[model samples]
Structure formats: C-alpha cells, structure tokens
Target: MKLPLSADPPAFEIRYGITEEAARRKGYEIRKRTAPPDPSPLDALLKKMSPEAVKKWGETLGGPGGKEAPNVSVTMPNGDEVGAPTTGCDAEARTALWGSVEHWLLGQRFGSDFREGLISRAEKDPAMRALNVEWSQCMAAKSFADLESPAKAMDLAASFYEKGDETTAFTREVDLAIADAQCENDTDYVRKRRILEDRYLAAGMGGYETEIAATRELNRGALVRARTLLAS
Candidate 1:
C-alpha cells in the first residue's frame, strides 16, 4: 500500500491544517482532563472529606456500595464501555478477580493450552474473535523470532517494513502470517522455503523480530546518548 504523505510536501502545508479549530479543541480537552490531580470519585470524596472524619473513619471503611457496589462505570471521551470499578471491590483486588473469571470461563470452552483453545473458541464468539486476533499477533511474533531464511525474512521485513517502525511485526503480522501460511505446506514432504531454513530447522523463526531489532537499536542509541550526556 502507498503511504499517505508524499516523500516531500510543501512548506506551507506543514504550517496550516484543515481543521485548526478541531485540533485546538482536542488539545484543550486533553489539557483539561489531565489538569485534575486525581479524577476518581473515591479520590474526590477523600479530598473533600473533613480531616476529623478521615481520622475517625480510616480510608476504605467500606462505602455504601459494599460487595454489591454498582459498577463504577466511567464515560471515556470515546463512547466505549471500558473498565470502571465495580461496587464493593478495591480497584486492584476486585479488578484482578475479573481476569480470573474470564480465564475460567475461557477454559471451560477452550482449554489451558493458549492458542489451541483460544483459536478454537474464538471461532464461535465475537469476544473470542478479538482474543483470536491477539493470538494471531502473538503467534506471528513467535514465528518471526525463529526466522531461518534471509529470503523469507526479507519478504516479511518488506511486507511489514512497508510501514517502517522500530520493532518486530512492525506494521503487520508478516512473520506470524507467513508461518501460518507455510505451516501446513511445510508439514507435508517438505520443500525448504528459504536458503537458511535448514541450518536453524530446530531454532525456528518468529514474526516480531523486526520490531524487536528496531526497539533494540533505539535503546542502544538512547543508551549511548545517555552515557555521553552523563560523561559530559
């Protein structure tokens, strides 16, 4: 796919944008939201409460919404229903419970095996479908790491490096997709997909090596810059 911006653009285009007001409004909203020191209802209540009252009743004496406390749903800027604190649970403890429940539920349908069960279940449910997307992403990353062939690796890097960035699986799941694509084919009376495929037949490749390399390069540069600054 072609990139959005041209290799070069006019200087005037850089200074002016189509929606100056909209951009300004977005910036203002971000500032306003960030200005609050702590924006939870619990935090607000504690701050407004009298020092005497705080001393008498210590933090978290169990408010009106105990175990059955209403879900502390918050309206994010976007209309999505992200996690809000449910009633009767501390943010950390209570929130952690949900993950356990989700896992147990998943295990019932799928199994303990991560991708095997996840992919199987995801085939049936929309929520599981999202999980499958994650599964694919992970498997892809795993695939790229064990990459054996420079030719195939070059192709993967080419496909995802289409959108250049610092890490493995840069713009797409090229590695994982490539592995999945070749997995079935490779299983039967094998033909070597790459020149180096046989050398590291045991080691195998993963998908996100590009991103990982990019990240390592960035970190190495940062380390050098930091060390230089410290020495100076």
Candidate 2:
C-alpha cells in the first residue's frame, strides 16, 4: 500500500527519530506505570512476590547470608528488566524506557503525525517530508485570482476526465450563443397555434404541417425548384 509519506522526503528523518526515541524511552515509561522499586532489597522483593510467596517463604530474596536476589527478581516474563525505575535504571535501560513511553504518548497526542513518521521510515524515506510540505502549501491557497474559465482552463486535467477534447474548450459558449439566437425566433405562448391550426402557419387541408419533413416538399421545395430552373 502507498503510504502518505512515501512521496515526501524529510518524513523519514522524523520517522527514525520518533522510533528511536520511543524505544529508548520505554524503560522509563514502564517505571511510570508500575509502583516504584524499594531501595531495600527485602522491601523490593516483597512487593514483587505473589501473595502466596510472602506466606510460604516469608519476604527475602534468600534467607540469611544466602541473600542473593533470585533470577526471577531481575527478569520478567518477557526477559526485560522488571524492578528498576527510570531514575535508577542504567543509562541504556533508561534511554530505551524513556524513549518507548514518550513516543507512545506522542502517538496519542499527534496520532497522524506519529503514524506517518513510522510509515515513512518503514516504507519510503527522503520523500515524505518534502511532499508533506508541498501539500501543506497547496492546502493553504487563499486566492482564486489565478482562476480560468471552467471549460477551457482545465487542460492539464483532460486526461483524468472521460470527456473528449473538442467539447472541452468553449463548447458551452458556442452552444449557448446558438441557443440564444434560436430562442429569439420562438415564443412561449401558443394562442394562434393552439386550435387545430390557430394563426400559426397551417397546411390548409390536412392538419397544419408542423414537422420540417412535411413542409420540405411544399412551397419551400417549389422555391428551390424555381431557383434551379432559373439557373438552367
């Protein structure tokens, strides 16, 4: 699928930064969600324990001098560190955690922006931002001073439309001009033409010839025949 940022350029940079930041921020982000770790191992260990553990073995990483923290204490189901807070976590861990959280919240705040960045990096780079800037400019257009006649102006757009080219330019004007001339010879009322053959031109015997075909062989034809005879 073509992503919005595909055609734009700088969008990829934004994408990379956002992803890196989000990943780096995750450790801090997780800390924000969970309860703070206790400095005292006993307290920290106790907090992580299931209710059943405090009762079965009491609260201790290990009883007495064997006080080494259990493997489970340091690692979680997914193998990521569990107890350390963003504040106390090592630099790398802190970077990842903090990045992870910030990018997540950023996604929520500016959803489309965040998603576009991800897409730009994943799909097309270099073109995303450039195209976005161009689009932003187009959308901001404020004036119609450059407008052209509707029928003639859309030349470049002809390919996209199904209409043929001849009727594309000034056709409406030509049609309208001829229509205006014809309308001058016609009227709205039919007072004379209303009755079988009111005052409107009539054939006299048969229903007045209203059709061009019937009148073509009448006086009109006689005039043409006479002109031909004169010429001969």
Candidate 3:
C-alpha cells in the first residue's frame, strides 16, 4: 500500500494558473513587494495555545501530557497567561468545527456524498470496471503490465518512492502518470465515470434533503462566527 504524491488528478484540458511566459515576471514582482500581510486574529488565538502547537497538534509525543498537551504560553499586557496551539492543531480544530459544511453542501447539491462514497461508487461501477479492463490492455501495450486499474497503476508508481533515489522515483512516477492519463483519454474513462456517477447520485438523493437544509442553516451561522473571530 503506497501513498500517492498528489491526492487528486489535475482537471482535464484546463490551465488556470500563471502561464509559463508570465510566471517569471509575476513571480519576481510579487517577491519585491515590501508590505507584509496583516496578522490574522485567528493566528494570534492559536499562538496562545501551545509550543508549535499549531504544527504538531495531532502528533503523539510521549509524556504525561501526551501530544495534545499545551507546551507554549502567551502572556497578555494585563498579566494573563494563555496556552497557544500549533498550526496543525488550529487547522484540525477548524476543520472539526466546520468540515460538515462542505459535506452537507455536496450531498444536497450532487445527491451523493462527494468524498468517500463517490470514489467507492466509481470504483465499483460496472462501466468503470469494463473501462479499467480496456485501460489495462492499453497499459500492457505501452510496456506497463500487471496493472488492473488506474488506481492500481498509481499505487504501483507510488511504491517506487519507498526505495531508490527520490529523483529516480519521481521520474518513474511521471512515466506512469503520463501513460495512465493517455490510457484514460483513449478509453473515454472520464466520460463513462461521469455518466455513472450522475446516475448513482440521482438514485440516492432522497435521504439527503432534510440534512442538507439543516446543514445549510448551521453553516451560515458558522461562517458568521468564523468571520467575527478572524476579524477580532
């Protein structure tokens, strides 16, 4: 079981970022700016939480306090001391508090769970399975054999990273990614996946309506609170 370098694939046929010619000039101009960004109030609050508490919030450092224990303290002008959190902790706390907002929105708008369920459905889809078979055949023709699916091919590519020089591993990864993308294009894999996904979402929409409405109201309130905190 190897981990992917990137968690998701690039969008097909779209280039939204700075172009190659524009990158050099824009990059230099941005770096030359003198004014620094204003400090975020949320950042100040997290800084009052622990030592690198922001970065190592979830890590398991052995001790009586464990990893979650506050290690850093901030003192106010009024002689009050407060614990500060690391970056990781602040991010995790924020997500735990508001992550449900996107989940509900996706379920309501798409009629399916966007994160795990959609991927599960796509993998198990009959059309997707057939496409994978075709894709595997295409890969074999390209001298990349023994791969059963795009996911499997990606996993194999990731496995290379566990040994050898990082540059070598990266080169092999690029080769595999190119071949996988080419196979997907040739087999119309993306089109078929989209069609099947729509069907799956349409069939499962009834159960999400009430939850979606409730989450919408909850998210609105949460956004307001978040704005207030950030502003403060």
Sort the predicted structures by lDDT, highest score first.
Answer: 3, 1, 2
RMSD of each: 24.6, 38.6, 13.3
Residue 167's lDDT within candidate 2 is: 39
Estimated TM-score per prediction? Answer: 0.17, 0.14, 0.52
Clashes of each: 22, 25, 17
Return the TM-score for candidate 3, rounded to 2 decimals: 0.52
Local distance difference test values of all predictions, in order: 0.34, 0.30, 0.52
lDDT of 1 by residue, 18-42 (tens): 1323332331122332255757896
Full-model lDDT, candidate 1: 0.34
Q: Lowest lDDT 10-mer window, candidate 3?
A: 1-10
Q: Give the number of the best model, judged by lDDT.
A: 3
TM-score of 2: 0.14
Superposed model 2: Cα runs more than 4 Å off: 1-117, 120-124, 143-232
* lDDT digits (tens) for residues 1-232 of candidate 3: 1111111112332111222233322321222223366799965776687665644433422112335643444332223333323233343444444554233232223222232354566568777788778989998999899898776765676677678986676677667666767777788777776677677655544545665565566667667767877888
- Tens digits of per-residue lDDT, candidate 2, 1-232, equal 1111111112322111112233333311222323465489766776787776664443221221222522211321122332321221232332343243222222222323333333324223234333333323332342212322111112222322244553342343233223222221232112211331221123222332342233333434445554766788
